[model samples]
Target chain A: MRVLLVEDEVRLADNLAAALRDGPGFAVDCAADGLSGDNLAGNRCYDLIILDLMLPRLDGLSLLRRLRARGDSTPVLILTAKEGKQAIIQLLNSGADDYLAKPFDLGELIARSKALIRRGKGQSHPVLSALGLEVNTLEQTVRRNGVLVDLSPTEYRILEYLIHHPRRVFSKRDLLEHLYDYNWEHHSNVIEAHVSNLRKKLDAAVPGAEPVIETLRGRGYRMAVGPEHTIEPG
Target chain B: MNQVKRSRSIAFHLIAAVLAVELLSSLLVGILSYGYERHIHFHAFDSILHGRVDSVIGAVQDAGDVDDNVMLDTADLHVPKDDIYEVFNSRGELLGRSPNWTGTSAPPAIPPHRHATFSEIKVNGREYRLLTQQGSRIVDPGDPGGGKLRHVTVIYGAPTERLWRAIHAAVQFYAAGSILLLAVTGPLIAWLLHRGLAPLRQLATLASRVSADSWHFSPPASARTTPELAPLTTAMENVLQRLERSFTQQRTFVSDAAHELKTAVAVVKSSLQLLGLRPRTQAEYQAGLERTLADTQRLEELVAKMLTLARVEDTGAAPGLPATVDLVQSMQQAAAELETVAKLHKIKVTMESPADEPVMVALTQEDCSLLLSNLLLNALQHSPPESTVELRTALQKERNTAEFSVRDHGEGIDPADLPRVFDRFYRSDPSRTRSTGGAGLGLAICKAVAERAGGSIALASQPGQGTTVTVQLPLTPNPDAASQLA
Candidate 1:
């Protein structure tokens, strides 16, 4: 998945962006001030935005308010220094999806970011399932009938986005838009390659398993509904 | 304590002055009224005595004979029981007297054509007011002088006991009236004073309610205040506003400190977690461990600076530490200690002191060293290579203070950033300070130390020219410079 981080502190922002990129398989773009962050957020299509409350040129709260006023509903997770209860209440009221105070655990931050992205895509549960295959968002791993299935980071992004809205057909352009930030020059064939790899992994992981991703004619991909399945607890 | 209390009680003093003035003036009025009433009573009694004496002369018409017989007629007159009368011829021979005249001699009779002579005399062991008069009958109407004149002297004496009794009763009434006037007005004055001071009492209540937990104090605008207390309310409000501002500033400082510390710890924690994520080659492991070690060192440095700042603030809060420090000696020691750093940076450290006597100040030796070393180290960090950093000490006897200054011939701070130089963790250029490994707390520590020593610190800088830091500490018990504590 694509992510955007807006923070003023140079070292903290760098380390956090690096961790997310190397560990969580995300295309992370960072902005040092609220002005640039606001500009980038308006122009880019990212799955999530991590915002710091204290920023130069404009504050995080004002930027958040403006983004929501302009009807941008990308999941927002705020990074705030301990500014007391009143500021926290104001931030939550101003369209922030979640918040993590500074000096927070890196594992917890990554977990919350994935959960927000899931919830933003109309998936209320932490784990999504299709035909006995499970996408555990909290553990950031997949399980097929009690067996581990490893996939490339890009393949995982496309699969997770598709699983959030099961059975919803997304064209090549639509998947490209959610899979890349504003700086990327995406090609539809590139997404085809990732999808092919993800299909091979899913089929090889469980023998005789039904294919979860189904391609429609003149359309893109969908998490196939071969049999009616209910969401199971992970 | 009583003397202090007496000085503070304005209400009591006001009432006391009013009572004294009221009582003294009332007493004078009472005395004046009594004197005037006595005059009126005596005049009326004297007039009555003269009138009675005049009628006595009329009663005498050369009784028995025209030559020697002188009688005051008592048959046709009803004499007062407390009064008596006597008559005498012009030759001073006793002629006729009233039956109540028991004294051997009457008051000397008056000559003809003379007004009544009133006198006080003791007669029969009783006090009497006597009036003497002279009158002639018709036997002297046809004569020119004394040839055919038959003149008689008449004296009338009236007891004054009854007149004094009435005057005494009126005097007592006047005294009682004065006391009654005070009784009616005393409490009314007290109530008025109390009502007038209600605003002051309300202000006291409002001040008492102010604490760290509660800052809401609403002064009563509708409460009445006199001109004297109006300023008091305004001054109190100003003080409360200042107090609130300080509290807010302190809160912001604590929150900022917490944020800095949290960020430091976060950097270290995230770096270690990421390094331990996967197995690596021996060289890569060494590199990762070294990187983690560096992060921990920075973290430790930040924590140490925070602790130093906290300790300085705490010391400033409680100033009971007794100490004696020589400003010049401390400056010399600090300059010597920075010799290695100066040599490494190719900067020359210079020390200057003109006085021979020790400049004793009220700060401990360790604190004085900390203050001087911080200033000198800051100067060294800012000074360019081959530049001179000067540390000097001087006695400012005229100002009753000892001065210590560290000046550097280096690029100075911008005018915009000069005002916030002493704020904790504030840096003019964050990237530059990071490269220099300066924690941005040197100037703040110096300022705190100076203030705790009953002194002040000031920085004067010209952009692109140089910078000078001057710390002036008041001397302890200077014999010739006693304005140190002022």
Candidate 2:
């Protein structure tokens, strides 16, 4: 999964980004000011946006308002130091999916970020299962027929993104934007290599199991949909 | 508990004064009217007595005797029943007398030149007014060319009891009128005064409602227009507005302080939490520990700055310290103390003074150092590498102030951020300043220190040229004495 972070405090942003990247294996992109954050959010397709209220150039509320005005429905998780119920309610009313006050536990932030990303794709549970393959979003692990499956962080993220949107076909560009942040150099073939590796792991996990991932010649990739691979609710 | 004595209301005092003056004037009027009435009554009584005596003389018509003497005619005399009279001829022979005449003192003989004489007498234990007069009668008007003069004396006396009673009645009427006037007007005056002072009472009620939470002060139109209350109403509005502004400033400062402290703690907490997320090699763990230590150090710095700001703000009056501090010396020491920081930033810190004489200010040594250090540090932080930060001091003799300033040739503050540069926890560029471990309390502390010493601090900056922060402190009146004591 991919996420964007907008915070004025450099150290706090760095720490949070590191936590999200290591814990949830999310491709994290950071913006230090509200103006840049707005620009990045407007142009990029992020599954989740972590916003800090007190930002330079423009405040977080105005950015959120502008984003919502343009009909960008990316799930927003607000980080605030303001200790008041009124401020929290205002943030939520301003198109924020959730909020966490500052000095919050790092573990809680990661958990909530993953949950919001999952819910943003119309899933409610932390684990996504399809074609006898179970992807635990919280633990960043995958299992085939109740057995552990070893996968690279990149492969795990691609599988997680594909599983969240079960039957949607994602082109190479879509996969690149969804699975990688700005820090990564995007080459069309990079998505191909990661997808190929992810498919190999899934097939190798259970030799007789049906294919969990499907590829169309021109339409790119989608999760395999058949009688054998039934998509669970979450 | 000590009970405060409630003073009399203004209306009460005013009404009492008016009533007192009215009572005194009424009494004066009563006395004056009584005296005037008595004079008129006495004049009328005298006229009646003259008329009665003349009638007695007329009745002394020719007795037809050969001597041509006048005799009293009791039938022709007409007077009050309580009156008495005595008649006599020129030879001093008594002709006739009133039956009530029983006094031992005889009436005085009328003077030859005087026509009448009047006096007050007490006869038979009764007060009487007596009139003695000389008169003449024409005994033979047809024989002589005019008339024959027959001289006679008549004494008439009337009791004065009725006159005294009439005068008393007039005085009583005046006294009763005065009492009635006082009774009617006393309450009228009090009610009028109370009504007239309504604006004052309304102003008091409105002023009493002012508090810390609510600064609403809308004086009634009556109070605003009243000549006596306009000034007070305006003064109260001005005071309340000033207090509200100060309260808002304090509230903003407190919230900003809380935000900064919380953010700092968050940075430290996240760093430690990130380090504990997974097992790592010894080298990776060592690097993570160092980074976490740095984050904690920044947190410690933020807490220390906040404390310094609080301490500087809480300083009231003049603390017990050296009476005077030399601005030139303080500047030099501050520049030297920040030498390492200046070196690290590749900036040169220089000091300039117009005179060799010490510019002594009335500030404590610690406060002087604090003000100088904060200004120098801020200047150095904003200055570019290999640039110069100038520290200047001068004694402004005309204004009686000691001026110290720091000038840096760096990227100056934007016009928008200039006004709030000294506000607590307000940073011009949050991301840039946060990386440098600036909590934005340095300039705030400098301002507090300057104001606590009866001084003022100001900033002037250009976007590209540079920025200069100046502090002016009141000069000590007896600098030499203070230095000697030190």
Cα lDDT, all candidates: 0.80, 0.87
Candidate 1 local Cα displacement, residue B387, angstroms: 11
- Candidate 2 lDDT tens digits, B1-486: 133237776788899999999999998999898999899999998888888887777677678788665677788667777888887777766778888886425546776688888888887788999898887777777875775777777888899999999999999999999999999999999889889998888888888898887889899999999988899889889988999999989988887877788888999899889989998889988998898899899989988888888888986644765478788888888988999999999998888896668888877777789889989988998999999999999878999998899999999999999999999888999889889889888999999888887899999999999999999998888768656634
Error (Å) of candidate 2 at residue A53 is: 3.3
**Location of the lowest summed lDDT over 10 successive residues in candidate 2 chain A:** A225-234
DockQ of each: 0.45, 0.79
lDDT of 2 by residue, A179-212 (tens): 7889889898998998899889889888877788
Those runs of model 2 whose alpha carbons end farther than 4 Å from true positions after fitting are A61-75, A84-98, A115-123, A128-134, A143-149, A162-175, A203-234, B1-5, B36-60, B84-104, B109-136, B150-174, B354-356, B395-400, B477-486
The alpha-carbon lDDT assigned to residue B315 of candidate 1 equals 59
Quality class of the docking in candidate 2, CAPRI style: medium
Best candidate, lDDT: 2
Model 2, residue B177: C-alpha shift (Å): 4.0
Task: Compute the DockQ of candidate 1.
Answer: 0.45
